[model samples]
Target: METDLLIIGGGPAGLHAALTADRAGARVVVADESFSLGGQLRQQTQWLSNLPGQYGYGKKRGTWVNEQLINQVGASNVQVLKKHTMIGSYLNGNIGVSDGDKTFEIQSRKNIIAPGAQEEAKVFPGWTLPGVMTAGAAQILINREKVLPGKRAVMVGSNDFSLEVARQLNSCGITVEAIVEEKNQIICSDGELVKTLENVPVYTNSTIEIVTGAGEVEHVVIQTPDGLKEVNVDLVCIANGFSPILEPFEIMNCHFVYQKELGGWLAAYNIHLQTTNPSCYIAGNAAGITDFGSILLTGEIAALSALEAMGFISSAEGTEQKSRCWRELANLESEKVLQARTEMLADYHQKHELDLPDYFMKIKGGKMYG
Candidate 1:
């Protein structure tokens, strides 16, 4: 397959990129590993609204915006390769895509990498047990698959996502044993979240020491200043932060920076979303772990940049559009950085530094847990 613009993800970012480029009179193809579109928004319990005059405000204002954006992408006549996993990219702008058994090579004049990020689970004893899962995974199961891992659950994290997921689980009649944070504070600045946490039993300065069960999770041992305590729980949801999925672009030697504020390593890009290699662009969580609204804006910027670079759009128009987009990106980046600093200060938890339980070495060899 060949396209003027090849988008390597189907999430909000990639979908928006495809739509933008297609609207700019460029042939676009979107390849996504997921069965459908919408990305993480599909798993969220409620929509988050951005403040007025905000850069990404209108992009992700409400539930209607998400639905409308996705519908627009689907209706744009964009060629979507659903369930296609892009395994690799070459220097000459060729992408390797696979769908389980078969593989296809897609050559593009310009390529956009928006593979997104993956949730990182800080290893603890019995973490690999059948009943234990990431908060994101649990949400997917409960929201999409209509299956609950267990009745009683322990959620470990202090982010807004963690709290929202806990609320969702509790609403579904799941017994939430407790929401534990290794720190003493809730890491969200949202006033609504703070009020919501008051209703749930929240344990501060605590970490899950061990999870014990015969073949599944039956109990979770937590370590706190008081002492070690055991709580009966059928499920444990690890809500550690996410890490960028940059392996595909890394193979292409794309330049990246380790930004602790952005949840670890992120591919480096300029205001135009051009990566180290000019022919290859990146956006969304694949570029960095920011909000969905920012990712969508970046995707649009990246598509416009790619279209301009490919001679599909005049330089004058591209420059004017890019200037407006860059201002918006800068504003969004500022807001995110502010929130990130607040969360970091509030949580006082270091990234990728959580102590792993001794049990992880027993089952999975001596490999270090992420």
Candidate 2:
């Protein structure tokens, strides 16, 4: 299929990018592997409001916004290829997209790769049991499918994402036994404090030694700093951080470095949102972890950058859009969200025998930087 632009993934990033590019007068084709358009929205049941000014694009914002975005995209009449996955990305700019048994060749003047992140799973005894599932999967089962993951559940993870997932489970009438945290402290943001107090105490510095049940999970033996504790639960939800879905980038040969802060090996890209390969761009959790405000703005910046490259917009127009992108981008930098990403991209440049961008070198700490 030939298009002015092709967006891979139907997540918040990709959907927003599609709207932006379409507004710029591009015939857009959005290819997402999911049967529906709302990516993580289907799995979420929380409302995170942004601080008045930047619009309603904040972390964990309500499902209403998700519905609003989807509605706008539908009303705009952009062609959506649902259940279509961009399977193979080649160095020559041609991509292979698959829905089921068939794969099609996609050629576009510009492409935005917003394939989103893959929620990770941790290894534990009997983790392969029937009722053992990723926190994301549990969310989907409850929020999207309207089916309970299990009657009672034990959550495993230390971050706000896990804690929020636990609260969602409880709201759905699923009894939560406990939340297992690998870190010694809770990572929930100040606003998220109420979730930890929702009748679910966190078990810090803990590990599930074993899960016992006949066919499905019945209970788990947790070993914590104090001692062994037996918890009875029907399900175990793993809420570990995610790894960016780099397969699309890798198909285009975007080099990645081991950056733990970004959740593992991440694609090399600069602040402008351009990858090492100039033609491909990435955003959202697909690149690294950051707030939802940054995610939406990055998607816009990435689309504008692609538009600039494709000569769809004038240089002056590009600059105007850039000012907005940079301003929003700055909102995330000092917060430790994009710090590791900047350092990693610099490292990627150094590994390729290139110099780090002048301004970025100073940002990584004066004495610690090379």
Candidate 3:
């Protein structure tokens, strides 16, 4: 298949990119591995608060937004390829995609990578146990599949995700024994989150050293400044962090920059979202782990840039649209920083380093060795 613009992802970024390019009258194709197209929003419990002093939307709202975007793209000439995964990309605009037993090749005038990020699970001694899972995976199972992994769970992490998962589990009648943060700091301080923490025990400066059970997680051993302690729990949720899925970009030899704050290595792109390779662009978490609103704005900007590059639209039109989108994105990012700072400082009285075992260190160094 040949297309004017080939977008290798169906998440918010890829969807928005298709919409933007299609609206500009460019031939677009979008592919994603999942059966659905909402990306991580399908598992997320609530919408991220991008603007301060505003009530954040929930998963349902996110679903509605995703559906609306998909509808718009589908209404246009954009080709939606759900359950199709782009396995590799090559120079000269050649791409390899797979769907079940079939593989297909596509040539495009331009490509946009938006494969997004994946949850990082560092291997601990008993990490392979049935009840162990990443925070995102657990949410996917419980919120999406409506399957409870366990009756009692112990969550380990000190981030907004950890707090949110704890609240969700408790609200669903699952006994969350405690939320353990290797760091003694509180990473989220939204009024709603704080209210949830009032009931769940928050353990600071602690690490889950070992999880032991016959076939599943039954007890979790934690190490804290005080001493070693054991908590009886049936499930353990690890909220380590996220790493970008850059395999497709690597295959295309796209230049990337390592940004610790943005969840590791990200494609190097200009203000227009054009990568080192002019024929390619990247946006959303695939570009870097920015907030959702920023992802949407980046998608729009990247699409306009791609359209201009392909001569489907004039530079003046692309520039005008990009500037407008960027202005809103910048404001949203600024507010996100303020909110993150406020949340970080709320538990300033207790701050410590992240507790990661040596094995996890090996895993991080292995896949994301960059």
Measured by lDDT, the strongest candidate is 2
Model 3, backbone clash pairs (residues 3+ apart or across chains), number: 0
Q: What's model 1's lDDT at 329?
A: 50
Error of 3 at 69 (Å): 2.1
Model 2 lDDT tens row, 1-370: 8898888888878888888888888888899888888788655567754421345445545476567668979988579999898889655678889889888788887778887788888998899999999988998898888999898889888677777788888878998888888788776775545544567767889889999899989979999999998988999999888888888888887777677777787777765677887778887778787655566777887888888788889867876776656554554443465677666666666666665434444445322312
Quote each prediction's TM-score. Answer: 0.85, 0.89, 0.86
Please provide, for model 1 over 137-242, each residue's C-alpha lDDT reduced to its tens digit, 9 standing for 90 to 100.
Answer: 9899998789987899999997877877887788788888888889888775667766765766777898989999999999898897788878998999989988
Off by over 4 Å in 2: 51-60, 90-92, 191-198, 332-334, 345-370
User: Candidate 3 lDDT, tens digit per residue, 186-226?
Assistant: 66656677676687777789877899999989988888788
Model 1 stretches astray by more than 4 angstroms = 51-64, 90-93, 332-370
lDDT of each: 0.75, 0.77, 0.74
Model 1 TM-score, 2 decimals: 0.85
What lDDT is reached at residue 71 by model 2?
Answer: 91
Best by TM-score: 2
